[model samples]
Target chain A: MSGIFNSSIGRKFAMALSALFLMFFLLQHFAINILSVFSPDAFNEASHFMGTFWAVQYILQPILIFGVIFHFVMGFILELKNNKARQISYAKNNGSANSSWMSRNMIWSGLAILAFMVLHFIDFWIPEMNTKYVLGDMSGMHNGEFRYFHELVEKFHSPIRVGAYVIAFVFLALHLLHGFSSAFQSIGANNKYTKSLQGFAKIYAIGIPLGFIFIALYHHLTGH
Target chain B: MNLTLKIWRQKNASDKGKMVDYQISDVSPDMSFLEMLDVLNDQIITKGEEPVAFDHDCREGICGMCSLYINGEAHGPDRGVTTCQLHMRKFKDGDTIYIEPFRAKAFPVIKDLVVDRSAFDRIQHAGGFISVNTSGNTQDANAIPIAKEAADTAMDAATCIGCGACVATCKNSSAMLFVGAKVSQYALLPQGQVEATDRVLNMVKQMDEEGFGNCTNTGACEVECPKGISLENIARMNSEYLKASLKG
Candidate 1:
């Protein structure tokens, strides 16, 4: 079973599986974040439960960390091998005929997403962990408002941060546009349903990232 | 027609190759692409110069012998045809065409416009066959009642001539399409059921040993394949591989 990771298709299969898992977590996190825009009390209630829950802390967080690390490390390794496969360059090469540019340049968007992920962790995840394990829940509390919601709104108050978030979401959208359906195709899920899968993936690729950007811009413009 | 050709030139596999330009005149539009090259070779020979060497046989296009990346497109600008079937009519007067060998880490240039494709043979030898008892007992082909769809798909996969154009056209030089076609063709047939597990596992392992890159789902192989092999075959191969791996 360990040999599976060494094969080309097998490596791609793992990449797709991890990507889909991360996407699921992203949607869950997005849903949680949107709650703050609606009501602070509701946001804090969910955040408190998420932070203190045993299953969420012990199992889910560790798996999420592994998934993220595997995705990044394997992605870079595969890109390196791909680069080594074609050493000499084509002088008059043309690319528009068969593949999308986004499919060809995944590493660029992926790197940008990695950069944003660090900041995202710093802004939310680290503080959540601190409150849950070491620091008390009152670390950043203000005026009886939820610390998580307050921290999120405060983070977006900086236009520079909001702008970076919006740009990272754009890169996320570009990465997902090719990554979504291609992940399914990579794992051999093709059939009559694949066309519909592609359609749904397109909507997902656009919608989720745009939703994130809207949330950031909404906070920046309207001071949510 | 008059054309300028920049053709890759090399003495042997170890020799460095460079594009050498040549002028050819009086080319007929009716000539096949190889025939146009034949005229150029004759001109070079008459001038007491070494003729450019390229791989080709069965100029009708089925043999998959002709391998060239012309004008940056594998097998020239035409779709679903090998270089032998490409006509000069697609090119125009005063055209400057670039001709080179297929580039891939697994495919080293053997000489001017010729690369060693024996890596494909090694990959095929790794699995591309079914195990059948040849001692006294033989099964009739008519005895196996295969569905029409399965038979058609097997034929579609069997059409790949192993020309290496897919490798040439691919950005990563991935041989997944070629390996996928071979694996799916056998997997689709009842006779292949006996060795399906080992066939996929060995062929895929051999493909990796050949140093081919990973498939990025670019769909370029299906586009440039002379046989018009479908990308769906790749998906089928992946399904077959996964099933086999899980069984282990």
Candidate 2:
């Protein structure tokens, strides 16, 4: 309903929904990207299918973009409103005594991830779009071969880029460390199952980003 | 114990406050923090200077009237105790203690170490009640059997003393724990179900209007709460609000 997004709870609920959506997308993205390490042919096959498939390209991609944008915009708005709610901060706040550093610094971590997203989009998504939509080349091919694996390898050849990526993934881990379980709490899922869910959240939070870092390093060290 | 006190001094609502330092000696370790402040105020009175003003009632801690941010921790360094209940033994001899009011836009300072928390009263006024028939008809207390678990949970939610420690300690100054406890105290009971929808919807509306921040589930409020109100109450309120909104 229209009124649902107006209240604090409603706004948080919306944020949680978008967060869960984006989390799912990240998992699938990681799944595909990991293929570049194990099997470049399979990676290219998955990448080409993902790129060229009409349903994924037309339907899911737009929703994914919207989810990302919505999450960021809403997060910014909440952060601004929350800052204003204090007006004047405590003379000396001992936030670490009660809350985790990651919990308190979600915005900074999120900003780091946002910066990474911009680089990621520029490095991969924009060029993919240009090749597929702008240049009218939906074939996922360049010079009679699939370009996905070669382009992926080419992108990882730079140590600076890899370093930036590794740092970004670290930030992503911090973000998810708080965010994954936090999204569940926001949606009112706190119960007997919450403990196990937190266990799973810890694994996903550390593991997924670690997995992404492994993929990036694997390509960078091996491809060279 | 000899202590140097840095207490916030503000004349009135419009006055900009500053921390004013005073030295006090022979403070008994058994004395409560408020009692220590009383000793300091007595020292100022003897010096022919105006004494510092802070809110307190029933010094035993149940009234929730006492609020002091001491040494960067709400209710001082003690866990699970109100400022009135915080004993001086926690601090070392010759300690320099800093005392300030609970900081939040919703809880603006009224005087030295006193903040106006009527914003909470306003939110309470919105829906923190249930309608019961009383004209020649009243339900017996034991007429409706409540599940033991539900009753115990509701009692836990009800134990919140409405202290602003949660807000003061929160990085965002969120009052979700307070509002969530209020909502859960009702939502968990069968008597509260009839008007549950409107109660949650209206309370949340009033809560936002009070300029309080949203919960990020940092778990800070729970840690700082004297009564140990759980984060589960907040999740309960979230689910309640969601169900109410979607029902429309």
Per-candidate Cα lDDT values, in order, are: 0.88, 0.92
For every model in order, the fraction of real contacts preserved is: 0.67, 0.77
lDDT of 2 by residue, A79-102 (tens): 999999998767777888888999
Cα deviation at A169, candidate 1, in Å, is 1.5
Writing each residue's lDDT as its tens digit, candidate 1 over B103-154 gives 9989899889888888899999999987777887788877999999999999
Q: Which residues of candidate 1, in runs, are more than 4 Å off?
A: A138-141, B135-137
- CAPRI accuracy category, model 2: high
Per-prediction TM-score to the true structure, in the order listed: 0.95, 0.98
Docking class of 1: medium
Clashes of each: 0, 0
Q: Give DockQ: model 2.
A: 0.82
The TM-score of candidate 2 is 0.98
What DockQ do you compute for every candidate structure? 0.69, 0.82
CA shift at B56, candidate 1, in angstroms? 0.5
